[model samples]
Target: MGRPAIEVQGLWTQFGNQVVHKDLTLAVQRGEILGIVGGSGSGKTTLLRELIGLQPPSRGRVCILGEDIQRLSAAEQRRLSQRWGVLFQQGALFSALSVFDNIAFPLRELRTLDEASIRDLVMLKLRMVGLRPADALKMPAELSGGMVKRVGLARALALDAELLFLDEPTSGLDPVAANAFDELIGHVRDGLGLTVVMITHDLDSLATVCDRVAVLADQRFIAVAPLAEVVQLAHPFIRDFFHGERGDRVLRAAAQPASSPGGA
Candidate 1:
């Protein structure tokens, strides 16, 4: 279709003698949520890190918003960072900072906006994530796991970024809370028209929020159009993940299409 918001072609990442990704290629369209799933140590996080410029890939290209990030000048890279936001595992909020401060941290660092403007923006973001104004004043440690995740989400939206990256957004929450979080992701993406790249273990989240998913296996990510197609992947890790013993029924139900009673 249109030019992709993020494109990774022939990406290869390595750690000493260990190769994490080999000839991996994928692309994320604008204003769409792309979920990445794989077993632990399958290099999902490694892929995300390289995409964000935290680590250099051994080979290949990453083009975000039409520019190769790895070849950019330092100033250009900084500018690119401002246009994107990330939520790491564990919410990664500053333990010492209040939730309000944590949310405002990015705005304070990147923008010329004054205190009043910053507060207004921060409050808006917090509210978007279903957090009350009063909740922002509390220390991050005082928040529940779900609340902390919301706060982290608020912070990621602080800059009004065009692109967002979430690493295991549902890692610590219970099933109910995780479902709620997935709904929130859907709402936020629609409300903001932002492209999302999420690395998630939660299959329900994939069915709920993702426009498409890429399964990482055998050192490459295979893009699958729908959850049903993904479920049929022949790779051991892919099959084990999509149709694993623990929750096959739920996945099957989630992937099923609704049918009418009368025959056509």
Candidate 2:
């Protein structure tokens, strides 16, 4: 097989006396969705920052699409960054910009497309994320929780990025909306042939769209495998997370046939 889309080796993160990651490593294959889950304060966000070059690891190597991010020059890094997109937990839309302008932000930054072309591409992205053209005129403040996520997703795909990073993609939505968002993620990934790495605590999302799930604990990834296989591990966190009341409910729901829209 070819090199993985993302690869981390001997990673370590430290903040003064506190060490966040210790010899952590992982690999994400091309065109697959990998879910990252960890308990509170497990440094999931920190790891993500390092992976995307927002923050540097104390000692490690991070490679994305075969380039070592830490070794890249500024111009090279900027060019490489355009190959991937990120969706922050709260959608992180520009408060002052309308939906149209928000989705157009990245494209405009490229300074390559004219206004007419930008408009056409923005509309296409909006449609790809299941939003209406008229909705593009609305401000971020006017959007619902689900709408915010959809808009964030649309912007994430605006660059036609080969890799997508999602921080808590399905948080703050009702079960139905979250499920719908998960379906949209799967649809978008397959349609765009994108490799996705998402940090999510939503079990329903893991069960629904993730090709593999990675658990972070004890300052490293404890297990990275399919949900069923990971759940079978002897780790305490795995047991509590997958066999607990909430986990059991989600697992049961996932095992059965697709339920009606009214179901959680």
Query: Each model's number of backbone clashes?
Result: 0, 0
lDDT of 2 by residue, 46-74 (tens): 99999899999999899999999999999
Instruction: Give the 10-residue window scoring lowest on summed lDDT in candidate 2.
Output: 255-264
lDDT of 1 by residue, 217-241 (tens): 8788765465667777677776667
Clash-forming residue pairs, model 2: none
Which runs of model 1 end up more than 4 angstroms from their true locations? 253-264
lDDT for residue 9 in candidate 1, whole number 0-100: 94
| Residue-level lDDT for 126 in candidate 1 | 90
What lDDT is reached at residue 67 by model 2?
A: 99
Candidate 2, residue 108: CA error in Å? 0.7
- Candidate 2 at 166: error in angstroms? 0.3
